[model samples]
Target: MTMSLGPYASFIVTSYAAAAIVVAILIGWVVLDYRNQARRLRELDRSGVTRRSGRSAVDTP
Candidate 1:
């Protein structure tokens, strides 16, 4: 059997691909961020991070 696209099939395919790529990127970002946050939380728990006032990372004038 021969399958055929009536019209705009190429556009539909591209759109689907783009949507999938976007979702994949978003999922990856979320996973990475969750991992980073978990690591930070672990470190904070180990070190007992407190809310002490100190010089910030960068010098601000």
Candidate 2:
């Protein structure tokens, strides 16, 4: 059996393939960045570095 996408098939197929490639690249980049950031945070924490929150600041009387 054979499937066919009549006229404009080439253009349509190419567009879909391009979009898929772009999405895959974006997902991979995000995953890598998350892992790198997490590792850095862990290293910082071990070295006595702290992440300050806005509310942690002392208020002046």
Candidate 3:
């Protein structure tokens, strides 16, 4: 079986590929940022720095 994209096959395929690449990059960036932030919070906690509520930075509730 085969599918056709008419006269704009290359354009359509390129657009989809570009979108996928952008989404992948964004996801990677978010994951790295989250890890970096968590590490920073841990360091702060070790140094006795904490929230104004006197709770650990890594703590939830």
TM-score of each: 0.71, 0.80, 0.82
Off by over 4 Å in 2: 1-4, 59-61
**How would you encode candidate 2's per-residue C-alpha lDDT over 1-61 as one tens digit per residue?**
8879889899999999999999999999999999999999999999998766534457433
Clash pairs (backbone) in predicted model 3: none
Candidate achieving higher TM-score, 1 or 2? 2
Clashing pairs in 1: none
Q: What is the lDDT of residue 25 in candidate 3?
A: 100
Q: In each prediction, how many residue pairs overlap at the backbone (N, C-alpha, C within less than 3 A)?
A: 0, 0, 0
Candidates ranked by TM-score: 3, 2, 1
Question: Candidate 1 — what's its lDDT?
Answer: 0.86
Candidate 3 residue spans exceeding 4 A from truth = 53-61
**Per-residue alpha-carbon lDDT of candidate 1 for residues 1-61, written as tens digits (9 for 90 to 100):** 9767669889888999999999999999999999999999799879988544555657445
List lDDT for all candidates, in order.
0.86, 0.89, 0.94
Best by TM-score: 3
- Where model 1 places Cα greater than 4 Å from the true spot, the runs are 1-3, 50-61
Q: lDDT of model 2 at residue 21?
A: 100
